[model samples]
Target: MTEPVVIGSERSEVGLPAAMEILLSGGSALDAVETALRRCEDNLEDHYVGTGGLPNARGEVELDASIMIGSSRAFGAVAALKGYPNPISVARAVLEKLPQHALLVGEGAAFFAQECGFATADLLTDEARRLWREALGPSVESVEGENTAAGAGDEAYRAASLELVRRLAPHDGPWGTINVLALDRSGELVVGVSTSGYPYKYPGRVGDSAIAGAGNYCDLRYGGAACTGRGELSMRAIGARAVVERLALGDDPESACAAMLTDAATLPDEFRAELRTLALTFDGRHGGAAGQVGSVYALMTATSAEPEFRARRVV
Candidate 1:
């Protein structure tokens, strides 16, 4: 039998180091996820998913996060929150308070976070304000170009068309969503995901990051899986958990990830044409492999064996 693996993600602002700290100290997988997520909130880089992430299309900075603990089958999720200090901790609170709740969003989600004793913040910082100001330039330029193209015909119609085009234009990264999965020494599993949704995405839009079984999954009966890259794409394909289910049906982690990626590739050209990539990590043992994309890793422990993490590039 395979030894347990402890997997974690440093997906943008979320700190894998904090989670690693907990797991290495022999803490529970669920606790490690909570601790790590809280640490991410504390970091400036991680500001995108908590108090300092990018604002929505309406110029609001809302957050989304979720967690699943496999050992107890406990789960919690929140979406479109405006000022959560530590979204992962709020998610854990939701799980502890109501294990069966499928989702919570908006002000309700914010209130829940507050009730759980998680701090609230302004949800914007000097950096975010600067970025937003910068984003306005391109949008203004795009509008100016649109007006020129239309050649001064109908004012209202031209303005509307330009606005639509500007909204459709894609910006550069740091991309949204970070996924994590860990299998503890006691054979328990936990999976978590947190993201800023899409940068400049429509307000009130929630991505796969907060959705169960899309960007993250955990199951002792099937191992663990987590996905990063494109939220809309991953959600539509049900990527992460789908990979784990494929593994349960008899496939290695590489093959499973490849299968789901293949499915993603088959998307309609317009959808496939955008910024795209999906990265996956699996920890059958507990501590998963780390490598560039296309690499594969595995681990094994049986009969009083001590745990270890191993890896290799699979072409």
Candidate 2:
């Protein structure tokens, strides 16, 4: 049997080493993928996810995550969850414990995590809070061509803050996420994703990170795929699923990802420039692509001693 391999989104270096350790020790693909995502989720230095996530306009942190086991086509997801730092683990629990359902959202997801004994914590960090405050300052919004301040005790300011968040949130700008894919020696594939969603988003807003076909998709017969960047664009394009479907149609992993990225480039400029994807085949072949120039992904194989950061071919 061939050794296992793992691939991840641009920042996966943060967790890829640990994931490779588990794979080298003969862990299951699902286990390795989950462990890697958990590491990223706990990393306080990463403001895009978990403990250091940026808050919503209301100054509350909400998280989204998903996991998929290719062999069984089983999926689990949580959206708009508050106080849970490791939503990837919560998603795995939802997959294992809740056989009939694939997704949970909001308070229901939080309640489910509590039932599963997941630890809860405030996900917002000081740095993220400071950024949120800065984004909501007096210059945040303009109404009727008049600059409005988001200062305290001002109704216009409050409305301006909300509008600013609405426009800039939900996968705009330089937001980030983690997408990890693993192929075990036994040929089983598992893909997982975790994100804080768009920084300073509205409360209760859920992005593609928690959606199965949008942010992630896997099939042992074909491969697996996961996406980052603008969640709305991915959701609209069915980004990850499109890549896997192309692989299913006999395209190599690289071609599959590049083709999807090319398609993404045709979207409106806002969504097009920020799109990115990573893919892995059942046989351990992997690749990535982006709609904008200079994007990259991380790769780790059984033959490699460390993860390699490779630049993506922009479409």
Candidate 3:
């Protein structure tokens, strides 16, 4: 029997442990990811995800979240919602409620989150307040620039590009993305992704975190993945799922991930930016693994022959 596997951004005092809890409880990938992200929502780092993410220029906390189930090709997503601490749950709700393939922004999404039993409190916390204050002064322009792009050239790229600026505005410290890939005890393949909106972002803009195959993807017959780093860069580039597709073609997870990064470098200047990282985990014929999560964006994999996880950095 293939052993169950779980992979995520890093071992946060909250996220990693939450994943373990789900795994230990015999939960599937869906449960694992939901549990992990929920834990993150409650932790001090809550500023980046759930209800605590930075608002878009309008000063609203619009959130985005998506989930993919490999077996059914059933995907769910929610964009630009406030009052929902865990947008993933709301995304799942959208998929379950609709007869079609997708959903979009506004009260429809927020109404859905409320129906799913989500609770909301004042989003700004003491930690986040301090973060914003400390980033005041010269950093203010950078932060505000990310929040609003009134002069931003075009509408098509406005939302995503603004998020990138917001993510980069805070030079306060480096942060990690939360990712998880796993096959449940029942043998279902699931992928989950969650992140706070970019820092200093306008209140309502949604990042790649809510986009499937960009932030994360899963294939029961093949493998699964999740990513971290600059969402705009990864989303426009289709980085994480591309790596998994390579693995399906018999490339080991490590090589497949490297291949994806290599291809990104060839893209024209219109696509290059600060390096984003991808953390992929799969239940290979060999076993489960936690991919590389590093500064320069990396990938990792595991196979049945060697259950141990291996990682390699890619620029």
Q: Which candidate wins on TM-score?
A: 2
Q: Write down the RMSD of all candidates, one decimal each.
A: 6.4, 4.5, 6.4
lDDT digits (tens) for residues 248-271 of candidate 3: 888766566666666766666553
Candidate 1 similarity to native, TM-score: 0.77
lDDT of each residue in 1-315, candidate 1, tens digit only: 223344444342245555555665667778866776666665665545666677765567878888887655567888888877677777778888866685789898987777777767887777875676576554433333443444554555456544653464334644445555665666677887776776666678887778777866666676667665557777888877777777788776656766777776666655343222222233453322222443322222232133223342221
Q: Pick out the ten consecutive residues of candidate 1 with the lowest summed lDDT.
A: 295-304
lDDT for each residue of candidate 2 in 81-177, tens digit (9 for 90 to 100): 9999999999999999997999999999999999999888878888777777676764543323546654554676667677776566433344588
Q: Judging by lDDT against the true structure, name the best candidate.
A: 2
Cα-based lDDT for every prediction: 0.61, 0.85, 0.59
Which of candidates 1 and 3 reaches a greater TM-score?
Answer: 1
> What residue runs in model 3 are displaced by over 4 Å at the alpha carbon?
11-13, 136-168, 269-272, 275-282, 285-312
Candidates in descending lDDT order: 2, 1, 3
Model 1 CA lDDT for position 105: 92
Candidate 2 ranges with C-alpha deviation above 4 Å: 138-154, 166-175, 268-273
